[model samples]
Target: MQSDKPSFVFTGWHMLAAMLLFFGTIITVNFTMAYLATSTWSGLVVKNTYIASQEFNGKAAGIRAMLSTGIKGTLAVKDDSIRYGLAMPGDKPVLADKVTAHFKRPVGEHQDFVTELEPAGAGVYEASRQVLPGNWIVEIIAVKDGETIMHEANRIAVTGEGK
Candidate 1:
């Protein structure tokens, strides 16, 4: 005589459930680690890049300092307008609330001229006028918080007359 006994056998559903749980946990953990690593590395890269870029720009600005003063590179002329660049010294960039550019005839009366308000960002302004150009003076005034601050690079001349 033999005793009746049953042996435990895993069904397809049991194997499927176990596989699903194992893979689900693995995928979730992988995603979490990836997210954290990416966020950390991206932040570090941004900070480092900003510092390095400022250093490079400082070096370039030093070389460019001479061009803004002497002949040839000092002037900014256009067909119908003129623009000049204003930069703050050191590593920091210029940020002004208001910038004004005034163009006038150097030798003649200053009545026949144009003045324009410049935007922020780059701090440049241009006022166009239809006048026979021989020699004109340009004045740039930058203001912040209702007070006049930086002003330089004056006495720019417009050379040729228009057709």
Candidate 2:
């Protein structure tokens, strides 16, 4: 008994189409990811690697010395105001002649700014500046009698609602 309907067959063209679709999807995804990565971040940590390497040990030693003092810092961002405070091991206020903060974006320097904080109280410093909500790398420096007492870097996320 011969039926009128004919069975379908998978031919070379079908195989070629399958391979093309598979490879095309993969290539498209790769190109999109590469473009996004290059466009977002410049991937630059330092201008000169050799100079940074040479100073690494000295910076490490300075950080160790700074930590030995058992000084702690606090940062508060509210609306357009930035506040910083320093305390000793026993929670005593650390008085400093000058306090400055360097705020930088993690991926770019376009939004970076340095502001000197005014003394609000014993160990409290405050600055009125508008910082956009995003990730920030803050470097706080406190100097007393022209000598650095505290030098610390901290990473913080600023949300839409300042707190």
Candidate 3:
């Protein structure tokens, strides 16, 4: 004898609903990710790719020449003070007339600023500035006699403590 209760059956409508739900969820997620990716970052590293490519070899040679000078640089950020130091192999100070530090955010240029560090001592330069808490890309250039003697780039993370 059969029971009075009706049994469940899988029909075309159920299949259609399931397929729609699966595809709809995937499409929704894809659209969301695409929007976020495009809206958040511009993904531009240089203003002109062709010009940058043309100058790449010269920049590489300049970097090699700078490295051969055996000058080492150190950067420190603490309590609204940004300090940079340059030294040789035996801790001897490097002779440079001017030093500049270009601070920029990795994703945007709104917070970018260039600070000309004044000489505090032998091969030491410093500036008093409050860096925001986030990721930064810093490019340091040391000029001596109208020529760049040392050029370096570094990535740093600033925390709430400014370290």
Per-residue lDDT over 1-163 for candidate 1, one digit per residue giving the tens place of the 0 to 100 score: 8767867889999999999999999999999999987764433324577778879877566447634533121236667655545554542345557766656554445344556555424545444544455665665666668754555445645557641
lDDT of 3 at 83: 95
Evaluate model 2: give its TM-score. 0.82
lDDT of 3 by residue, 1-163 (tens): 9899989989999999999999999999999999998887889988999999999999999999889989999999878999999999999998789999999898867889999999999889999999988999999999999999889999999999665
The global C-alpha lDDT for each of the candidates, from Candidate 1 onward, is 0.57, 0.93, 0.92
Candidate 1's C-alpha runs over 4 A off are 1-75, 90-92, 126-131, 161-163
TM-score of each predicted structure versus truth: 0.43, 0.82, 0.86
Off by over 4 Å in 2: 3-6
Clashes of 2: 0
| Candidate 3 pairs with clashing backbones | none
State the local distance difference test value for candidate 1: 0.57
Q: After superposition on all CA atoms, how large is the RMSD of candidate 2?
A: 2.4
In model 2, the Cα lDDT at residue 30 comes to 100
Residues 1-163 of candidate 2: C-alpha lDDT, one tens digit per residue:
9999989989999999999999999999999999999888889988999999999999899889989999999999889999999999788999999999999999867789999999999799999998899899999999999989999889999999654
